[model samples]
Target: MDLRQLSPTLAVSPQILPDEVPALAAAGFKVLVNNRPDEEIGAEIDHEVMAQAAASAGMGYHYLPFHPGQVTPQLITDFIAATTGRGPVIAYCRSGHRCTVLWALSQAGKRPEPEILEVAAGAGYDLTPVRPLIASLASRRG
Candidate 1:
């Protein structure tokens, strides 16, 4: 998969399959966060399959389906808690958009505006549309 590093702790990629787990493990990603809803994709890439694969590979897994306008504080909290101490986390969705949004929100206060923007851009995710929200999140941390 084409995985892009958003930070030392986080990476983003398109939807990943069971076969890709070895490569992910080899790449040093200790956690796999699935942001795609199961129904959106076919059965092949459902949460259960990915979760089994991740578990088999001895990696931590979290299924946090991020539907547009459905991402809540609880989801973010769960995502953060699941990713905590899980170094080199990799989050994936259809086009990596959901994963990008989750990562941005997760970094709300821990990272600066410019740094967050730069990191998102570097990962090929343009956060211009959500700049205001990002700014608000960053300010909240201050």
Candidate 2:
């Protein structure tokens, strides 16, 4: 798992195996957010399996699956609700890019644009392509 910390409370990663859940829990992550859809993964490592692993490892699990371009406003809203005050969370998708994008978008009104971009860049993600969207969301919050 190439876990990339985007902030103190949030980290994103590529797909993680069920066996890896305990390590994540041990890492102090109280929640595991799955951004990968069920259809995209094998049953051996689907959300059900991951969720069970998370439960056994003593971490909360949330399924908020969606493709990269399929993100809706409701998805972002749910992402915020699922993670806020839930303690440190590790959200995973195929390459972690989608998770990073979601995290960036969720911060629109709460954080400065430059800081959001900078944080993503530090985590090896380029949010430049989504800057306009971020800006748009931020403007709406004003």
Worst 10 residues of 1 by lDDT: 133-142
Cα RMSD for candidates in order: 1.3, 0.9
**What is the TM-score (0 to 1) of candidate 2?**
0.96
lDDT per residue for candidate 2 within 25-133, as digits (tens), equals: 9989999999999999899989899999999999999999978688889999988987889999999999898899999999998899999999999999999999999
* TM-scores for every predicted model: 0.93, 0.96
After aligning candidate 1 to the native by TM-score, how far in Å is the CA of 40 from where it should be?
0.9
In candidate 2, which residue ranges exceed 4 Å CA deviation? Answer: none
* Per-residue lDDT of model 1, residues 36-74, tens digit only: 899789888799999999999989999999887687878
The residue pairs that clash in candidate 2, if any, are none
User: After best superposition, candidate 1 residue 61: deviation in angstroms?
Assistant: 0.7
Least accurate stretch of 10 residues (summed lDDT) in model 2? 66-75
Question: Cα lDDT for residue 41, model 2?
Answer: 86
